[model samples]
Target: MSTTKGHADRDVTEDLLDGVAGWGPVLCHLGIFELVPVTFDLGIPLVARWMNDPAVAAYWDLAGPEIRTTRHIRVQLHGDGRSVPCLGVLNGTPMSYWEIYRADLDQLARYYPALPQDTGIHLLIGAPEDRGRGVGGILLRAVTELVLDKRPACRQVVGEPDVRNASSRRVFRKAGFDFVAEVDLLSKRAALMIRDRLTLYPYEIPRFDGYS
Candidate 1:
């Protein structure tokens, strides 16, 4: 059976995000970017639109016709409870799509030696305006820091960008991940990249008053 079971603890992550304080109080970020969990109450339509955008679909390799509908997104969110659907918001506007998950609970873990603490990322900038402007690198760095900081047990952050996606590889390198050879996965050759926890932050979980 799968180690990952059940659905998202919508109450825990969603309800705990921001209660009586409202949207303003719940707004947290790493520098300029805000990462929010994609909840059923508020994130469904938003993510659906982003996924259907031509530019976003092309960059994310989903350039087909209406492939990522709301239903598809919902099913993806239920993946073993380890996958988290998130949006990268800047100045209250969503700019990117991010899927943060545990590698040990993922099929990708079979491609390499995955530790229980290995967290993986699937990222894509949603807008054409956001791409080619170094936003991917900056966001990736902040995201890596955010993930490593938020999950104390995560010893490393990993990514497997298709080898043909040179831009993504460069962004990963800029965000402190070292290239670890090409691996065949899902019938595509991917470049394995990793960044150990010790390299980014010396402390395991640093105190962040506003953000974690």
Candidate 2:
């Protein structure tokens, strides 16, 4: 019964996302220091840094620190008409960075229906010095609020954290994302979490796909 209920919730959430994919704000990156507009040029380098961060690469599918890998991420950023918004995580002190991206609506719809109506948040604490300072929690909320402020079309923000990552799970839950699913993929297990826009800032809740 518990499993069935979980699936039911996910199905409904997906439907909700699909229903609102094209409704509001198109692209915006909300960060601590500034509210920057979205663009491909800004997105590529940030994603390159994210993909190459050893901390992030350890669990993700991307290769580490390779120029070629960065190039590949760059291509993806430009090839797709996706919007990537990156924010430097500075809360009266320096810490790691956080980025949120929106991909082509129809492509996202392939994996999860209604994904076009949302924006996905990917949080990375790559800077070792920033690891234990309670900054992850701050980055999570700030980024979400930023998205809500810039793009009112986003209805929900989603994240996929490995189930083994207890710290991250706590962060997402604190940010108000409910657990939607736990599944095995490419030999690892991960959790699907979503934050509702209505419960979020007052934006229209556009669909977004959560990717690492």
Q: Which candidate is the best by TM-score?
A: 1
Give candidate 2 misplaced runs (Cα > 4 Å). Answer: 1-31, 35-54, 61-63, 83-95, 103-115, 184-188, 201-212
Candidate number achieving the greatest lDDT relative to the actual structure? 1
Q: Residue by residue across 104-191, what tens digits does model 2's lDDT show?
A: 2423333344444577665666566666566566557656765665566777777767888787888888777888788554446777
Q: Any runs in candidate 1 off by more than 4 Å, and if so which?
A: 1-5, 8-31, 53-55, 59-67, 201-212
Candidate 1 residue-wise lDDT at 109: 81
Poorest lDDT segment (10 consecutive residues) of candidate 2: 1-10
lDDT of 1 by residue, 145-187 (tens): 7776556677888998878878899999988999887887764
| TM-score, cand. 2 vs. native | 0.61
